[model samples]
Target: MRIQLDDLQGPEIHALLEEHMRGMHALSPPESVHALDLDGLRQPNVRFWTAWDGADLLGCGALKQLDAEHAEIKSMRTAEQHLRKGVARALLAHIVEQAQALGLRRLSLETGPVPGFAAAHRLYQAFGFQECGPFADYKLDPHSVFMTRLL
Candidate 1:
């Protein structure tokens, strides 16, 4: 699979992001949903990416720069058809590598406690992320699980 920066302008990418947001909202209560919408992902500090296998879109992920030494991972979603295919693993590794290249010292993320997020928690743990309290504008929420790793 090939991974590259995405501008969130194409129909395919837009659809994928829309699906991601819908899924997030479905899995969590309104107050606990933190997934960024299309407009939010377009913010100047956020960099988004997509993974593709030739013409097929496999998954997408993003890195948001919180500060010189910190960043947040966002919008990590694998297409339903691509689930369990290692698309997320590859994309996450790419995100971590890009964060390191940017000289960021830490990478953190917030995911839900729902069963749908089990694979994500395992993946993050395998990458050395440990559970942590919320960071960046986030408050303690029973539905949200925050994880972070040092670069």
Candidate 2:
């Protein structure tokens, strides 16, 4: 699988982002969720990517530059059909590598706060993320579990 920079207009990437937003909205209340939509993600600070197997998009992730030394993970999602196939793991590892390569000393993220997100939380923990305060432009929200890792 190849992970490459994504154009926000890419169909598969757009669909995956929409699916992630839908999943978040369905699982959590609107007021509690703060996922970036297409417009939000297309901002100058974010660098997005997608993992592809030939013509198929398996997963996607993004790193939003908070500053020269800090970044935030965003829009991480595995296709429903590709769940449990290590797609998300691969994408996540790619994100970490990119963060390190960019000389970002810290990486932060926001996820859900329920068992439904247990696997994701486990994945982040395994990658060295620890519970942390809200970073960048985020606010403290019980619905959002924030984490950070020093690279």
When summed lDDT is taken over every stretch of 10 residues in candidate 1, the lowest stretch is 9-18
Runs in model 2 lying further than 4 Å from the true structure: none
Candidate number achieving the greatest TM-score relative to the actual structure: 1
Tens-place lDDT per residue, model 1, 29-110, is 9899898889899999999999999989999999999999999999999998899999999999999999999999999999
Candidate 2, after superposition: displacement of residue 129 in Å?
A: 0.5
What is the lDDT, from 0 to 100, of the residue 15 in candidate 1?
84
**Candidate 1 deviant stretches above 4 angstroms:** none
- Candidate 1 matches the true fold with a TM-score of 0.98
RMSD of each: 0.7, 1.0
Residue range 16-132, candidate 2, lDDT tens digits = 888998999987889877788898889999999998899998988999999999999998989898899888899999999999999999999999898878999999999999999
